[model samples]
Target: MPEARAPVHVDGEVVASKRIGGYRHLTLTAPGVPERFRAGNFVAVSVAGHVTRRTLWVHRVRASSAFGPTLDVVVEARGSGTAWLTAQPVGAKVAITGPLGRAFALPKEAVSCLLVGEGYAAAPLFPLAERLRERGCAVSLVVSAPDEARLLSALEARRSARSVTVLTADGSVGQRGTVGDHVDDLVRRSEADVVYAAGPSHVLRAAAGAAERVGAWSQVAVETSMPCGTGLCHGCPLPVVGEDGVDRVVRACTEGPVVRGDRVRWDDL
Candidate 1:
């Protein structure tokens, strides 16, 4: 495994911003950040006139654009902080600190993999899928949302993943059901040797359980809130069993954001 580079605080310029589905997709020129970016990494952006920094998934990285190296982020307008991020226009300058957190570990050898995601949180999985395909792994992706408008990259998944499956509660785009209803089938059909997932806690739990049932390894990118992305505040606590079989609390932003699904104390969290 390559060593992770140190995170840098940079003032990124928003080169492009677009509204896609229920999320805002922003492409920014983050000079130092993009080169170090890996799948499952996130950025902490300074919210205008706020003490808190809103963390967002670093959706993908563009190695060479007209503006130089850049990274993409998918922002959902939920709270005031996120709303501020989405409201930024083209050429807007925003403070960005990344690439933070441990990234998903790719298999050392070619193997079958399953990636599951929900809503806009699916951002990180796209890059991961690409990396897996490069390693000659059979990549299968599953994206879900409540409606068609919330689905992310259903069409693009066909181009990247060897197989694609979509689920929506309203049957707006694909099969009618929730992740809990279809994840097991997705796991079995993919014949996955490894499973990776991102979304809400419930969705991660479901994916983890399904993988375990089939005796496959599982890794999940947790969507926990962070007050300080660099682990200063120690605000986001994640419960997990240490290698010594002892329970311990770790900072999600530094210690994880991505962790072994089997190691997490799901019920405690």
Candidate 2:
């Protein structure tokens, strides 16, 4: 686990926030963060105090040949933590931490990549798709959302990919079931060599199962709320393979927010 450093005090004035049905797509510009941050990293922002640092993956690190760096984080305005995150005014001050966490196992040498995400899970994966494309890997994003409007963001992600397929629970987008339902067909048709997923435990489990059935390697980013972002807190221990198939605990804050799907002991959850 990394040391718990003091958060950089930043003032992120909300540039734009759109309500796409049940979720809010927020684009904030915080000037204090350094420009060297990669796409799949995250920034932890303080809401009330140090105990509850709101962790948000970098949805898109918006920088251009002309424009300055800006970060986009999707905030679901459904809970106390999220609701408070969305309610901040335009000029509100925010305390944010480093572009933490390791990058996903995306190798430029791979022929093609398949990315699967749900809700805020799409954040880090979105940037990964763009990076893979830049590295010449054929990227395909298959996203699952709850409704039609929520499908738009997934559609945008497809533009960066070689192709995109969307699945919605209500039959409003690409398919009428969970994204896992279409994994077999998508992999067969796209001939993707690697798979990456980030979302709830069930989603990762489902994805890992599907990938395993096809003999494809799978990786997932797990989420946990910890009082200390560093491993010393021992508050975010996740199950990992220890010896001869026994499960050992690893701190999510330090070892990973990202773990290979097959290596993680999901049953311990």
Q: Which numbered prediction scores highest in TM-score against the true structure?
A: 1
Question: Over 4 Å off in model 1, which ranges?
Answer: 1-3
> What is candidate 2's CA lDDT for residue 1?
17
Please provide TM-scores, in order, for all candidate models, with all chains considered together.
0.98, 0.87
**Residue 160 lDDT (model 2):** 76
Residue-level error in angstroms, candidate 2, position 18? 3.1
Residue-wise C-alpha lDDT for candidate 1, range 1-269, written one tens digit per residue:
23236889999999999998898999998779988988988889999888979998977799998999999899999999999999999999999999999899999999999999998888899999999999999999999999998898799889889999999999987899999999998999999999999998888999999999999999999998998898899999999999899999999898889998988899988
Give the number of colliding residue pairs in candidate 1.
0
Count steric clashes of candidate 2. 0
